[model samples]
Target chain A: MALLEVKDLKVRVEEREILHGLTLTVNEGEIHAIMGPNGSGKSTLSHVIAGKPGYEVTDGQILFKGEDLLEMAPEERAAKGVFLAFQYPVEIPGVTTMNFLRTALNAQRKARGESELMVPDFLKKVREVSKSLNIPQDMLKRGVNVGFSGGEKKRNEVLQMALFEPSLCILDEMDSGLDIDALRIAADGVNALHSPKRAMVVITHYQRLLNYIVPDVVHVMSKGRVVKSGGKELALELEESGYTQFEDAA
Target chain B: MNVAVAKTGSGRAVSDLFASAEGRLPGSPSVIASRREAFETYERLGLPHRRIEEWKYTDLRALVGEVLPLAAAPDAAALKRAADAVKAHAIAGARKLVLVDGVFAADLSDVRALTAEAGFRTLRETLEKDAGLLTTASTDAVIALNAAMATDGVVLSIADGAQLSAPIQIIHIATAASASAFTRSQVVIGKGARATLVESFVAAGAKAYQVNDAVIVTVGDDADVAHIRLMDDAPDAVNVTSHFVTVGANVKLNFFNMTTGAAVSRLQGLITLAGEGSELSANGVNLLQKTEHGDTTLVVDHAVPNCVSREVFRAVIDDRAHSVFQGRIIVRPDAQKTDGKMMTRALLLSDEAEADNKPELEIFADDVSCGHGATSGALDDSLLFYLKARGLPEKQAQALLIQAFVGEAVEQIADDGLREHVIGIAERWLERRS
Candidate 1:
C-alpha cells in the first residue's frame, strides 16, 4: 500500500468548498511538488491534511499508513508522523524556542508511549541540529519566532522539521521569503531529512525552490483539482509558459 | 436600594465595631487617637461603590457585604498549622516572619536570625512606643480602616549601604474558621541599601475568612529593592491589600503581585517618584477561575524629573471568573523628560469569563512621554493551531500559551530566584486549570 492515499477528498472552509473531490497517492521515499497560482487551494490542501480547525472535510477519505487521517486531531496527526510547515509561521512571544521545541518533542514522544527525553540528551540534539542550520545560540533563548528576520523564520521552520522528524512532511510556501543563501540552507535541511521511509509534499507558488530541492513528481493545480501531472520537467515547462495554459486546461 | 440605607448599614456596623474595641486595641495614646479619626473617615466614606471613580469596576458594597469579626489569637494547634504552612511556602534563603491568626507567631518565625543581622521590630511593640508610623499625608479611606483596625504586623528597616544576602519573607496565615484579620507593615530601605522582601497571604485549613492587609515602604536615595506578594488564600476568602511606595533619587524598585486563590480580591498600589533619575518597574499576574473576582488598581506618579516607570499586568480567567485592571500614570507639570508606559492584557478562556481593563494617562508636562494601552482577548487561534500542529495536546498547548502570556509580566522580576519562584507558582496554577 502507498504511504498516503487520498480518495475523493472534498473539503470546505467557512461553508465554501475548497478541495473538490481530489484524489492522490504517494509511495514511500517520494517527493511530490504541487505548483499552482494564488488561491488555487494548494495551501488549503495541506492544511486539511494536517487537520487544521475551521476546514470541514465534507466528503473524503485521507489514509496515512493505512489509517484514516481526517479522523484525527491536529496534534494526533502530528504524533502519527504528519507535519505541516506553515506558510506564515506564528510568532509566539514569551515562549523560548528551546522550551517550545522540548515541549513538542516530549509530547510526541509521550503519545508514542515513549519515555520523556532527558534534558542533556535533548539539548545535545538541539545543539547539533541548530548548528547545521546556523541558528545562533541566542536565538534559541529568545521567544519563538519573535523579532526573527524572514530568513530566520523560514530557517526556524526547517529546524523544527529536522527536530520533529515527521514521516510525511508538507512544506507550504517554504521558500517564499528566503534569500538564496537561506533557501539553500533550508533546502539542505529538507534534503538531509529525506529517507526511504519518509514521504514529502512541497507546495510552492514558483519554480525557484524546485531548483534546490528537486522533486520526483510535479503536479499542476488550478481551481481546486490537479489538472496535470508530469515529471520534474513539468515545473520547468510551467515556469517558462506560466500558469495560463494549466488554467485553460482546467 | 436607597443610598442612605446602603451607606448607613455597613458604615454603622464598622463604626460600632471600632467603638466597641476602642480601648482594648493595642497602641499608644496617639495611635488610639489615629484609630478614632480613621474610623470616622471610614464612616464618612462608607464602602466604596460604583459611584466612586476609582472603585468603578470593584464595588465593595456589593461584592463584600459585611466584614467578618476580628480573628482571635492562634492557640497551640493553630500555631502548629501555621508552622506547616510556613514550611510549604518557605522560599530558599529567606528569613521567615510568620503571622498566625492576625497576631505575630514568633515561635513560628525566624525573628532571631533576622534581628541579628537587620533592623527588625514587631509592629505591636513599635506602635506601643511610637505612634509616628500612624501618620500619612494621603487620605485613602481603606488605608485609614487598616490603620484603625490593624491587629499586628512587622516593622523592618535596612541600614545604609547594607546588602542583605537573602530575602526577608512575611507570611500571613489565617487559621480561623470564619474570621477576619487586619494587618499593617512598614519597610524602610536606607541609602545605598539593597534587599528583597516577599509577602504571602494564605489560609491554613480555613473557610469564609477575610484579610485586610496594608504595607507602606520608603526607598532611600540610590537604594534598590524588590518586593513580591503572593496571595493564595482559601477559595472562599475575601482579600484586600494596599501598598504605598515612595522612591528616592537614583533608586531602583521592582514590585510584583500575583493572585490565584482568593474568591474576591482587590489589590491596590500607589507609587510616587519622589526624586530625580528614579526608575520604578511594576508588574502583576492574576490567575482566577471558578466564580472568583479579582481586581488590581495601580497609580504611578512621576512627580520628579527624569524618572522612568513601566507597568505591565496580565490576567488569565476561566470558568465564570472576572478580572479587572485599572492603571493610571500621572506626570506632573515640572516632571519633564519623564517616561511612563502602562499595558494590561487579559486572556479569557471561557465564554462567561469577563475581563475589564482601564488604562489612563494624565500628562501635565509638555516634554514628557506617556502612553497606556489595554487589551482583552482569547487565545489566538493561529498560535494555538501552531502549537497543536507541533504535536502538543490541546490542554498542553493551551497551558503553554497561557504561561507565556503571564510570563511576560513575571519576567519583570529582577532577581533570578524570585522570578523562578513566581513562575513555579504560575505553573502550578496552570496545572490546576488543566
Candidate 2:
C-alpha cells in the first residue's frame, strides 16, 4: 500500500481551478522530488494535502495509510504524521520559536495519545535539532520567524521537520530565496531526517537543491498535473530542456 | 452663557448623593468650597453623552443609568475581604498600599515603611490641611465629579534623588456591591528619582458596583518611572479611570494599562510632555469578552521641544464584546523636533464582536515628525492555517494568535515579573474564552 495516494485530485480556489485532475502516489521510504515551474500547482497540491483552508476540493480523493485524508482537519492530518514545510513561513510576533516548537510537538503527541514530554527533555531535543540546523540558541528565544533572514526562516522550518519526525514530508519551494550556503545547510537538515520508514515529497523549480538532497524518483509537473516521471536523472534532463517542453507537452 | 440642559438620571442621583454625603466627607472649609464649585461644574456639564467629541463612543449617561450611592466605610468583614484580595493580587517585593471602599486602609498598607522613603499621606488627611489640593483645572464632567465626591486615596511624594528598591503597589478593593466608590490619588516623583508604581483595581465579592477613580502623576526632570494599571473589576461593574500625567526634561515614562474585567469601562489618559528631551512609551491592551465594553482613550500633548512619544494599543474582542481605542497626539506650535507616533489595532474573534480604532494627530510644529495609524481586522486565515498545519488545534491556534496580538503591547512593561503577571492575566482570559 502507498503511504500517500492522490486520485484525480482537483482543487479550486474561489472560482478558479488550480489543481486540475492531479494524481500522484508516494510509497514509504522513497524520496520523490516534484519539479515544476511557477503556477504549475505544485504548491496547491501540498496545501490541499495539508488541508489549508479556502482551497475547495472539487473532486477526487486523497488516501494516507489507507484512510480518507481529505476528511481530517489539518491538525488531525499533522497528528497522523503529515507535515508541510510552508513555502513562505509566517512571522508570528510575541510567540518565541522555542515555545511554538514545544506547543506543536506536545499537541501532536497529545493527539496521538502520548504523554507530554518533560521540559528538560523537550529543551534538550530542541537544542540538539536546532544546533545541527545551524540555528543559534538566541534565534529560538526570538519570535517565530519574526525579523529572521530568509535563510534563517527556511532553516527554522527544517528544524521543525527534524523534530516532528513525520512519515510523509512535503517541502514546497523550500530553497527559494536561499543562498548556496544557507541552501546547503537546510538541505543537510532535511537529509539527516531521512529514514527507511519515512517518505518525502520535495517540490522545487530549480535542480540546484537536488544536488544536496538527491531524490529516488523525479516527477515533472506542468499545467496542474504530472507530465512525466522518471529516475533522479529526470531532474537534470528538465534542467537542460527547460519546463517549456513539459508545458507544451501537457 | 449656560445653556439649559436636563440632567440625566445618573447625574441627578450623583448630585443628591454628593449633597447628602458632604458633611462626612474629609476636607477643610476652603476645600468644601472648591468641592461645591466643582459640583456646579458637573451640574452644568451633566453626564457626558454621545454629543461630546471625547465621549462620542462612550455614552456615560446611558451606560451608567442611575449612579449608586457612596460606599459606606469598611467594616470588619469588609476589611477582612479586602485583606484577602490584597494577598491574592499583591506583587512580590513591592510595598502594598491598600484602599478599601474608597478609603485608605492603614492597617492593611505598608505605611510606616513607605513613609520612610517618601512623603506619604492619605488624601483625606491632605485635603484637611491643604485646600488647594481639591482644585483641578480639568473641565471634564467625570473628573469634576471625582473632585467633588472623592473620599480617600494616597498622596505619595518621592523625594529628589530617591531610588526606590521596590515597586509601590496601590491596590483598590471594593468590598461593597450595588454602591459607588470615588477616589483620587496623586504621585509626585522628584528630580532624578526612579520608581515603579502598580495600581490594581479588584473587587472582593462585589458586583454591580460603580468606580470613579483618578490618579495624578508628576515626573520631575531626569526621573525614570514606569506606571502599570491593571483593571480587573467585578463582572458587572462599571469603572472609569482618568490618568493625568506630566513629564519633565530628560524623563523616561513607561505607562501601560490592561483592562480585562468590567461590564462597561473606560480608561482615559491625558499625558503631557511638559519639558524638552522627555520620552514617553505608552502602550495598552484591552481583552474583553461576553457583553463587556472597554474603551481606552488617550491624548498625548507634546508641549515642549525635542521630546518623543510612542503609543501602541491592542484590543482583542470575543463574543459580542466591543472594544474602542482613541489615540490623539498633539504637537504644540512651539514644540519643534517633536517625534510622535501612535498605532492602534483591534482583532475581532467572533462575527458579532466589534472594534473601533481612531488615531488622530494635531500637529502645529512644522519641523516635527508625527504619524498615526489605526487598523481593525479579524485573525488572518493564512496565519491560522499555518499554525494548524503545525498540529495546534483550532481553539489553541486562535488563542495563540490572540495572545501574540496583545503580547506586542504587553511587552512594553519594563519589568519581567510584571510582564509575566500581565501575560498570565491574558492567558486566564483566553482560558475562559475557550
Top candidate (lDDT): 2
* Colliding pairs, model 1: none
Looking at model 1, residue B50 earns an lDDT score of 83
Residues B1-434 of candidate 2: C-alpha lDDT, one tens digit per residue: 22355353344565687788898678998888888888788778877778898989888877776668889999999999999999889998889999998999999999888888888999999998765666666889889888888999999999999999889999999999999899999999999999999999999999899999999999999999999999999879999999999999999999999999999999999999999999999999999999999999999999999999999899999999989899999999999999999989999889999998888899998999989888888998988998999999999999999988998798889799988888887888888884
Poorly placed runs, candidate 1 (over 4 Å): B1-3, B6-16, B19-24, B28-30
- The Cα RMSD across the true interface for model 2 is 0.6
Best by DockQ: 1
Candidate 2: residue B93 lDDT (0-100)? 82
lDDT, model 1, position B273: 95
- Under CAPRI classification, how is model 2 graded? medium
lDDT by residue (tens digit), candidate 1, B248-325: 999999989999888899999899999999988999999999999999999999998999999999999999999999
The sequence of per-residue lDDT tens digits that candidate 1 reaches over residues A22-107 is: 88888889999999999889999999889888988889799999999988989999999998988889999989999999999999
Whole-model Cα lDDT of every candidate shown, in order: 0.89, 0.91
Worst window of 10 by summed lDDT in candidate 2 chain B: B1-10
